[model samples]
Target: MDDPVTFARKLRREQTLPERRFWGLVRPWREAGLHWRRQAPIGPYVVDFVCKARNLIVEIDGDTHYSEAGLAHDESRTAYLAERGHRVLRFTNSEVTQGGEGVYTVLMGVLGEPGAER
Candidate 1:
């Protein structure tokens, strides 16, 4: 496998459609002091999005994530992250593509910026 940093860089360039959309949606949050990173490396995993200041990691799940092996992997990953004091939020690709506003609303609450105008 490639180095985590190098793999993360590649992921940033080859973002899924949902990733691109979610990144765009959250990019403006930096003005609120909630900076975000896309395709960021955390230990051995490359998370879809993360806000280090908040210790939050957001994952966009695709079909592969619903598989048996995938579920196990995610469980371990989530546990590893939790042990390190990071909160993980997983959303399906369809959720982002179809219910982006709702997802944003939830994220604002998690980030303690509930009053942020969408």
Candidate 2:
């Protein structure tokens, strides 16, 4: 397994556009009550986004994720998180970046604040 520190450092240096956009848009909600950690280490897997408060992990998948191998890997990762009592929410990169408002709405729904606009 890779070192947690190293993994976090690498993630910090290589954040994708969707990751950055999501982070920026979610900052306010995080400040309000939801605490989130980017590239969080959970056992051997490093989640893209994790909200410890809600025990939820949000993953933004790029085009590569549509591949069979990527789907298998994601399934395994999701199972691990599920076993540990964490809910995983996946979003495509296009959905997050291109559909910013829609993405925020979905996230707000998941957060149990349906009417609250971010």
Candidate 3:
């Protein structure tokens, strides 16, 4: 990808099955004012999802992401984003495809209603 914005757009267009599933679950919450952007760019990386208001970035890790090099890269990326005061959340592809219950639980735990059940 030439630029982060362009890359993000491409990611949005070419979403994986897990990505599509996760997005479908969250889109309605976004419409209700918990704003979110799919395939958003922050600095040099393109995150799977971002909530600017919350300074949160969410990434969906596929099998390749478990490789040594990928793990190192993800660590650096997380550190870089953290340096800029952003929180990163990661979910595995299977976790998403399997129903995204854990993903939702974490998200809500981080950004849910004040009195909502955990």
- Highest-lDDT candidate: 1
In order, the Cα lDDT scores of the candidates are 0.88, 0.85, 0.85
lDDT of 1: 0.88
Query: In candidate 1, which residue pairs clash?
Result: none
Instruction: List the candidate numbers ranked by TM-score, top first.
Output: 1, 3, 2
For each of the candidates, give the backbone clash count: 0, 0, 0
Name the top TM-score candidate: 1
Error of 3 at 111 (Å): 0.8
Supply candidate 2's per-residue lDDT for 84: 97
> RMSD per prediction, one decimal?
2.6, 2.8, 2.5
Q: Evaluate candidate 1 by giving its C-alpha RMSD to the native, one decimal.
A: 2.6
Clashes of 2: 0
TM-score of each: 0.91, 0.89, 0.90
Better of 1 and 3 by lDDT: 1
Residue 42, candidate 3: C-alpha displacement in angstroms: 1.0
